[model samples]
Target: MVDADWKPSMGFIYGELRKATQEIKGALNDNENAYKPILDVIKEKSSKRLDTCLHMAAYILNPYYYYYDPLAKLDVEADDSIVEILGVLFPGDYELQNQIKMVELPMYKNKLEKFDRPIAIKACAVNNEKFDPANWWDSYGGSAPNLKRIAIRILSLTTSSSGCEIIWSIFEGVSNFKS
Candidate 1:
């Protein structure tokens, strides 16, 4: 995260975090009795430290995880509260939110309009490793303008405020020079 080029988008964070947790759990003791106790502790601690609406929203907005994660089923119902963040984002704009939820979201999820085009359909299948999901909105999401904006914003956001660290370092250098 300290390196801008290497910083993952906020949208990918929770899914990757989940994958990491799953890997650890799967690699632990085979006996459920033994591992269950440790797994519960791990879950408790990790959820307290890491779970947030931001993470859930990011996971939902990014199609790579939302539509096609191999590790786990994308449970939209489980992330309902995070989905409501979109409502809060526009604050009192029920019509727009309704359009997003009722119309735009479904189209994108179902791969209609430009999203159904050959180039877009091939995104997840052929060139998935090279295709950036954030850019998908810009290229093939014109029909769902509202979701396109939300997706891009969430998917493009850096996982950390590492730019602040650079500024802090510069300040420290200045302070040392003064001393």
Candidate 2:
């Protein structure tokens, strides 16, 4: 989830968690007796790390998963995450929150009005090789300005600054070599 090239989004956090859960379960199934303790530890650590409202908000806002994902909902409560994010975006503004939840959010969620346009619909194509969730919001989210702002801001965040650190280390190595 910490790719530094602007490719990783918070939505991938939940996706990774789900993938790991499935893989661990499947791999452990063959040797349940031997791996039960190990599997339990993995599950505990993963849940502690991956369980967060941020993950839920990202998963819910990312149109790829929110719109097309057929799997059951994540363990977090959707309402709680949405409320928490909205609160952060508009603290002490209950009216705005309600409006977003009632009007703007639903428009995006249901693909209403401009969201239903062919271009917008095509933008949410998760199967596309170059699909960037933030870009999708930037392109098609104009209809819901408030929700659009938060979606773009949140989705644009890099999962990690490690990429920058790696680049800096590489630069340091090159500089030292020159010295």
Candidate 3:
């Protein structure tokens, strides 16, 4: 059963996602190569840094993305949303952010398929209760506004104290797999 708070308004999310997809598409079309690095940043965001944000948004939004019967097969509008949101939410962070320069999960580095909502949901499920979002934010080195928004959303979703538990759990879970 759907949770009581799970308002099924995928349309709103989908609209935002679709817009992001269009923006990415436009960028790619304009320069073709100048914006390639942007794709890299987006990939990083989807796989590790902001995977929960992308996954949850897609889970809530993609249901309403309308399409004609012919082109329905190539639907990645959800993924596109994740990338776009990252670009907007983190204007210069992608380029400024230091690369981990490690190797274990190739999926974290160059695999887009590993970034689906199913993966994100599963990751969250395995986290223990001790996980705290505020601590996670501190670890990830987030800014004040970014951290605050994340805390609010996570607490709102997990329905816990307006403290750090829910956000921490989510951060730790999602951080385990970064590409």
Using lDDT as the measure, which candidate wins?
Answer: 2
Worst 10 residues of 2 by lDDT: 70-79
Q: Supply the TM-score for candidate 1.
A: 0.71
Pairwise TM-score winner, candidates 1 and 2? 2
lDDT of 3 at 93: 78
Listed per model in order, the count of residue pairs whose N, CA or C atoms clash below 3 Å is 0, 0, 5
Backbone clash pairs for candidate 3 read 108-179, 109-179, 132-168, 133-167, 133-168
lDDT of 2 by residue, 77-159 (tens): 75468888888888999999998989998898789977898887767766354878888888888889998888887777767
Question: Which runs of model 1 end up more than 4 angstroms from their true locations?
Answer: 1-4, 29-31, 70-74, 125-131, 161-179
User: What is candidate 3's lDDT per residue for 1-179, written digit by digit as tens?
Assistant: 11224432222232443346558869678575766677667666545433444444333222222221122224455335444554556677764222211221112223223323353323333223443323332332222334234333433333223345678888889999778
Q: Between candidates 2 and 3, which one is better according to TM-score?
A: 2
Check candidate 2 and list the clashing pairs.
none
Comparing 2 and 3 by lDDT, which wins?
Answer: 2
**Residue 88 of model 1, lDDT score:** 76
